[model samples]
Target chain A: MPEPERDILGGYAGDLLSWVMGRASSGDVWVTIMSNLNIVAVASLADPACILLAEGVELDDGVRERAEVQGVNVLRSGKNVFRLCAEIASLI
Target chain B: MADSVNFHFDIDGDNFTSAGEASVMIKKLLRQMEFSPDVIRRVSVAMYEGEINMVIHANGGTADVNVFCDRIEIVLKDNGPGIADVRLAMQEGYSTAPDNIRSLGFGAGMGLPNMKRYTDDMRIESEVGRGTTIYMTVNV
Candidate 1:
């Protein structure tokens, strides 16, 4: 069988939350613009490989602290949500 | 494992941020038990949706989970104003939640549908003026 896709970026907090909870595999990356602390909770529940905050948004201090405790890899992009998604799509 | 385990939690309806706490804890329990990832995910999503519903519609509720060898059963009971139309409520895009709820990134009418989607078996018992009970099972 062919290998499962890796590093594919999925966007939208709600849809991404659903997909991460349901469809996303263990190593897939999630890209979204939502900066709330709940994003960390969703990541913990979904067990995504990593999370990318797009649209040049910075993580809240609480979110960053929790991410450190949870060991969730988080990255930020200077681009917009749409542009980041497109770039992630190209990688896949 | 030959023994069955039971877990119970009180969901706080007033706090949206804490809605999914029970589900999150249950996920950890299942993982510690070495349940399959797929099974764990299904249970997590189903229970999370139920928890969210209880917080959003009902003024919170009680969640009971029974973990068996072959299946995991989740029961959510709420005393909130019961669902008027189970059929309409079951629809994918139908929502009675207010605008305030939508601002919180929920109220998209996907809660019930998502709960059903993630479970192997689901049953909803509701009385218009009384309350509602949701029973969902995910096979291990």
Candidate 2:
């Protein structure tokens, strides 16, 4: 759980991976409960600074592997997506 | 690079979740080839949108990317239902996608326009009930 070295400027919240893919911006933190391989892909394609997995959802090995290989930073939270997003916004 | 390198991918239309795989792969290859971040992002977004379109409209398709020193070329071909009105289809907000597609955050009708916006050159050929082929190039 290394803190993301890349600085995040803002955040986006969505569960549908494609929706996140089309709108997430570079250097933005992505807020989602999606912990799938495509989430990793979408994060990579969107060039987001990091992906915050809300609600403490667990990522299976496949998704973990993809995130590691793709260099997508995944952070976890016990809070809901809305508050998590707001906190991320304050951090940047 | 001394010679052109080509990357080919099979876009599985049945799997909406896997649509961006090819674009992600190409992004890696482009980065390895030392393309700038801006060019890579443009090509990746344009190609991702095209790949998603293939899966959404066609059953599946083929994406071929050729990388050269000065530019990258992408050609996508599918045997799915051809667009009835290419002009209308290319409009930024006109989408023929069903309601289900919108729930997935796609079928926004921005695919073709986004493709054109990112690429330096674009040509689309289609025949009703036949198929469609899109050719696009991004300069380095």
Candidate 3:
């Protein structure tokens, strides 16, 4: 978990990489169901606080390794995107 | 050219997993060189978009980053099916990427626009069959 204590200022939920790349703010908690290697690349460029993988999505070993190498914090939730966003909103 | 430091990478066309490696490297390099966070973000975002475009549209391409005292310049050259319409491609929500790429979370037509949005200047040179070359500069 890189920057474990970093404040989450906002949230963005998108499956489209380009859309997320353009709009996801630096400190936003990015929520998405897309699990791929490219997600790490996007996270690194966007510098999101963390990536919240909704819908109980799991990362493959290769992607997990990449995320670790890139120092991107990733979390998983069985709950859907809406609930995650709601929870994130309530907390931050 | 005399004072600029240049970095070059040959993007691999066949591997979707490796597409943005160059941009990532450049981002780290810029950070190490102590460029402002905003400048680093802008250059990396623009370069990342261009790298993805090359992988998606062209088979592969070459990316060149030149770091100078006042600005950073990026040149992307690809020998693939050229853009049919530069103006149309520049419009948001206008993408030619196939459904497979879209399924992977790209091809929404925001790549070119985002690149233009993050860079100070951008120019595109493409031919119907030969290739496409894009030049972009970000002010320091």
Candidate 4:
């Protein structure tokens, strides 16, 4: 959690990496169900506030390790994408 | 060109996990050079998409980044397989990538368009059976 206090301005939920990359804004809490190494790549490129893995999706050891090494803050939630987005919308 | 700084990298197509290494490296270098955050993000994101295209479409390729005072230029060259129709490939939702790639969260056919979207200028040179070369420039 390099920027643990990084401000969260909005939320974006999508699984299509390219769509997320093109639309996700900086400081946005990006929600997705995709758990692959490419998620880290997109997160890095898009500079999202943090990656919130929805629907209980978990990162593999390799991806988790890479995410940590890349300084990408990732959080896992058992809630589905809609529910998580709702919670994020309420909070931010 | 005399004052420009050039960096080169080889893309490893066999490993999907390592695909964006070059873009990440260049992003770090640009940060060290203190380029504007917007410029850094645009350059890195554009290069990352190009790298993924090479890894997913072409077997792999070479990437060169030339940083000048006024702009940053990225040149990606791949020899695996060239794009048949440049126009079609540039479409937002058009993709020729197999199902496995989509499962990995890519192949949404957004690579080329995103590259063009983020960069100031882009040009594609491809020969169907030979290879593809993409040139992109982002103004500083």
- Top DockQ model: 3
Report the lDDT tens digits of candidate 3 across residue range B4-116: 98999999999999889999999999999999989999999999999999999999899999999899999999999999899999999999999999999999899999999
Please state the Cα-based DockQ of model 3 relative to the true two-chain complex: 0.89
Q: Candidate 2, TM-score vs. the true structure?
A: 0.82
By summed lDDT, which 10 consecutive residues of candidate 2 chain A come out lowest?
Answer: A16-25
Better of 1 and 2 by DockQ: 2
Once fitted onto the true fold, the runs of candidate 2 whose alpha carbons sit more than 4 angstroms away are A1-3, A13-23, A33-37, A54-65, A78-82, B1-3, B99-101
How far out, in Å, is residue A49 in model 1?
1.9
Give the Cα error of residue B109 in candidate 1, in Å: 1.3
Model 1, residue B120: C-alpha shift (Å): 0.5
TM-score of each: 0.87, 0.82, 0.97, 0.97
Task: Order the candidate numbers by DockQ, best to worst.
Answer: 3, 4, 2, 1
Model 4, residue B4: distance off in Å is 0.4
Runs of candidate 1 exceeding 4 Å displacement: A1-26, B1-3
lDDT of 2 at A18: 44
Give residue A50's error in model 2 in angstroms: 1.3
> How would the docking of model 4 be graded?
high
DockQ-based CAPRI category assigned to the predicted complex of candidate 2: acceptable
* Model 2 Cα shift for residue A83 (angstroms): 3.0
Q: Per-residue alpha-carbon lDDT of model 1 for B1-140, expressed as tens digits?
A: 66779999999988877668798889889999999998998898889888878888899999999999999999999999999999999997788888877665567777788889889999999998799999999988
**How well is each residue in A27-74 modelled by candidate 2, as lDDT tens digits?**
888888877666777778878888888998888887777788878888
